[model samples]
Target: MPGRFFLTDPMAAVADALNVEVGVVGNEPARRNIAPGQEIVVFDGALSRMRWGIVPVGRVNARGRPVMEQIINARSETVFDKSAFEGVGRAVIPVNGWYEWTGEKRRKTAWRIAPKGGGFLYFAAITDVWTAPGGMNVPQVAAVTCAPNGDVAPIHHRMGVLLERDDLTVWMGDDLDAAKALMLPSPEGRLEISEAGDVDWDGV
Candidate 1:
């Protein structure tokens, strides 16, 4: 899974690659360590900034109790089946790569995972709007995850559902079945994973 994401690429280049407008989220500065709850660029039909975590404000469980925790990632297997995810919109999180950790907490090693040939990785995501008190609306998103591929299985048990450039439209399309079919592991050997050194964990 992508514990953290890094999008060092320029917004203009990302817009060109996705063939979409940059929209309100203009050419912002590069971010090396994008954590959950922070605003990240999201592409539904156009690019926009959205909080990386979904706050299930009024969502209730089977017993009609409030769901207190914010969701940063949703499993692909039950994303659609869950009542909590009802009315969620489809979107994509385009990033240069993501970081994963292995071993123990303090002694853990950070691994950077990216496209082998150096492009962008589009993570399938769900979008929602959380209404804060005093009538404030916050747009939010959460990445969808599936079983890890061969390259990721050794380091992590799950990985974000990545979509091909050609399949991005389908993933954001109105057809749920077509979009669900795109939620699968990226082809093995297409990603290059290595030690993530030189990253400042304390800085953005």
Candidate 2:
């Protein structure tokens, strides 16, 4: 599961890669250790980071209120059947690298999985709008995850479904079949792994 990521590219680079002119919503800075509930601007859309965990449709209060259970990652195989994802739309998240943990929890190792050429990866995702108690509504985003590929399996058992620039439209559109087809693991030799550096990304 991808709970955190880092995007070091500038807004111009992202826009240029997306082939867009200029503006995009929530243009945040490039940084490390971006956790859940943090906004990120991708090639396809600017996502208003979601709270982590999924809330079932039937999970309500005495008055039949909606709960805000959220999750950062959703299994590609089951996202279509998840109740919380009903009417969910798609979004893109551009990431340079994502981290994985190995060994014991207390003394685990952090590894970064990235493109072999040290470029960006466009991650496919599903999104929903969650309304707050009063009236505020925020978009919830969960990147689709599949079985780890040959390159990533050593560090983790799951990886985000990465898409090429050409597939963004299909993913964000109503082409269910085409979009689903893009949810496979990255091909062999598509990734590179390395130890993560300990940096105070908060200051970034």
Candidate 3:
């Protein structure tokens, strides 16, 4: 699973790559350990922070967590049918790299996966808004995952879905069926992996 990631590309580069303009943000530096519930960058060429977990609408529990439960990664096979992720629309999570753990559960090793050319990966993600007490709404996101390809499977069973520039329109537009058709394991040789360095977000 792609549980953590780093988005070190400067806003300008991210905006240019995504072909969108930067919006408002509090000026946070890139994060090395992007864990659950922490705000991460989203594509729209904007810097909006979302709860890392995905909580579907109409499922908020009185206990605070969503009644439906949150998912860190949405499996590609069921994303379109699962009530949690379904035809819900799309977004991009721009990242320099994502980390996957290998080895036994007790002492797993972490590996960093990036695009073969060392450029940013425009990860495919889905988003929705959940209501809080007193009608407050919170936006949340989930990264879409698929079976790992040849280069990345050594570290994990699944990898995040990625979108090339050409596919962004299908993903971000109102065409759910078309976008779902594009959700498949990326072609072999599309990714490269290496041992992660000291967990430094800025160093990427």
Candidate 4:
């Protein structure tokens, strides 16, 4: 699951790595426990946009609150037809690392999936903004998920659609075909999972 992750780097450092200007998230605090339904930053190769959490179709509203679904991850195989991410919702999240937990509830172990040098992990995601019945615009976004690679399968069955710095333009471009083709699991050794250092998940 891509349910919880961290963006430990400053906005400026992340922007430089993506070659995009640091937008509204100037000096924003690093997110240690990014969950669904909360606003997060995403990059589109050239521009950075802050995206709202996703709410799947048929559950747009829960009473007066935004219907938050257990949809932090999207399957790459059916992304085109999934009710939550049907049309055009291409986006990428440049987070430094993602967490996956194992073991029993009493003794869980959290693994931080990231690059060898602790570089960024440009997690592939999909986003959409549609007008509500009341004419209030609502934006929903979710990261894409694929079958875990060999290294990750032992820890978790699913992982986010990981991307490289060079693939930014194609992953976030207009050609849907090309983007979908890149939704496979990261290659073996492409990512390394280590026991996460002490982090304050509640700080976010």
- Any residue pairs clashing in model 1, and if so which? none
Whole-model Cα lDDT of every candidate shown, in order: 0.92, 0.74, 0.76, 0.76
Give Cα distance to truth, residue 85, candidate 3, Å: 3.3
Q: Candidate 1: lDDT over CA atoms? A: 0.92
* Candidate 1, superposed: residue stretches over 4 Å from native: none
Ranking the candidates on lDDT from highest down gives 1, 4, 3, 2
Order of quality (TM-score): 1, 3, 2, 4
For residues 8-37, write the lDDT of model 1, one tens digit per residue.
988998999989787787767899999998
Lowest summed lDDT over 10 consecutive residues: which window, candidate 4?
59-68
Cα-based RMSD of the predictions, in order?
A: 0.9, 3.5, 3.9, 4.1
Best by TM-score: 1
Report the C-alpha lDDT of model 3 over 1-204, residue by residue, as the tens digit: 678888776777777776666665436576677887777888653667777787675543345554466776888888776554544658888888888877888877778888888778877888887677799888788898888777877777888888887887788888778888878778888787888867754332
Number of the predicted model whose lDDT against the real structure is largest: 1
TM-score of each: 0.97, 0.86, 0.86, 0.85
Give one digit per residue, the lDDT tens place, for model 4 in 1-204: 686767878999988887768877776787787766677778765444544456554533324444446466778888776444546567788888888889999798888887877778888888777566788766657788899899899999888888878887898888888988899998888788888768666667
Model 2 stretches with alpha carbons more than 4 Å out: 24-27, 43-68, 201-204
Q: Quickly count the clashes in candidate 1.
A: 0
Task: Please report, as a residue range, the 10-residue window in candidate 3 with the lowest summed lDDT.
Answer: 58-67
Error of 1 at 170 (Å): 0.7
Compare candidates 1 and 3 on lDDT and give the better one: 1
